[model samples]
Target: AQSVTQLDSQVPVFEEAPVELRCNYSSSVSVYLFWYVQYPNQGLQLLLKYLSGSTLVKGINGFEAEFNKSQTSFHLRKPSVHISDTAEYFCAVSDWGGGGADGLTFGKGTHLIIQP
Candidate 1:
């Protein structure tokens, strides 16, 4: 079975500062990587993904992450964050089994607190 683990449950940062949310996964087969952001009482939006090609992947809202295969880690980073960046961030992965399954498994989620 595949699973994801978020290193931190919460990250606090001041407005205009930077932040990083750590994520790790365990899978026996190859898979796709994705990051999602969810605002209060809202559904998740795709932040970024690591499909094929470059390990460095960029996402919306000035967010980016690197796919490290050896470490089995994908850490999200934002150089400068804003107050509006406050939300819940999730690290997810999808399989390529073509089993037509839901193809999505997410971490518990990390609360991003952006201080004004």
Candidate 2:
């Protein structure tokens, strides 16, 4: 079964500090990589995706991630985080070839705490 795992359940950091949310996946077939962010009662927004080509992918809100094929990992990183960055981040994966689950399989979730 194709699955994604986030290493951290929560990451606390002071305002303007750097942070990283680790994500790993195991899939027998091709897949799409994604990072989604949810703020409070709001819905999630697409941060970035790695469909094909390029190992390092940049995302919204000053965030980025690198896809490591050998390690089967895609870890999110932000050079500097702000208080507004406090939210829940989810790592997801979807079947690239279709016929599988159309929707994403999300990680448990990582609560990003940005303290001022």
Candidate 3:
């Protein structure tokens, strides 16, 4: 079984500033990690993912996350953020055996509040 934990419930950052959202996970077997963003009144969108190969994976909207196996962490980071970036971010994990059938387990989510 795999589970994701988002350390922060909310993150407040000024527009154009850098930010990092902490995420940790625990699993008995290897699993794929992902980050998804949900804007107000919208569905969740895939931000980035770490399945294999490179430890550092980049995704849409200038966002990236590093897969640290030793620490069991996949933290999201952005160099600069825009007001449009403000949304609810969720960290998710799924095992390869599931193959999209079981779906992913997600964290509680972190509200990214971009302040002026």
lDDT tens readout by residue for model 3, 1-116: 78899999999999999999999999998899999999999999999999999999999999999999999999999999999999999999988865555579999999999999
Measured against the true structure, the TM-scores of the candidates, in listed sequence, are 0.96, 0.95, 0.95
- Candidate 2, poorest ten consecutive residues by summed lDDT: 94-103
lDDT for each of the candidates?
Answer: 0.93, 0.92, 0.95
lDDT of 2 at 105: 89
lDDT of 1 by residue, 4-108 (tens): 999999999999988899999999888899999999999999999999899999999899999999999999999999988999999999887567774789999
Q: For each of the candidates, give the backbone clash count.
A: 0, 0, 0
Clash pairs, candidate 2, are none
* Model 2: CA > 4 A from native: none
Global CA lDDT of candidate 2, please?
0.92
Better of 1 and 2 by TM-score: 1
Q: Rank the candidates by TM-score, best first.
A: 1, 3, 2
- TM-score between model 3 and native: 0.95
List candidate 1 segments past 4 Å from native: none
The better candidate by lDDT, 1 or 3, is 3
lDDT, candidate 1, at 2: 90
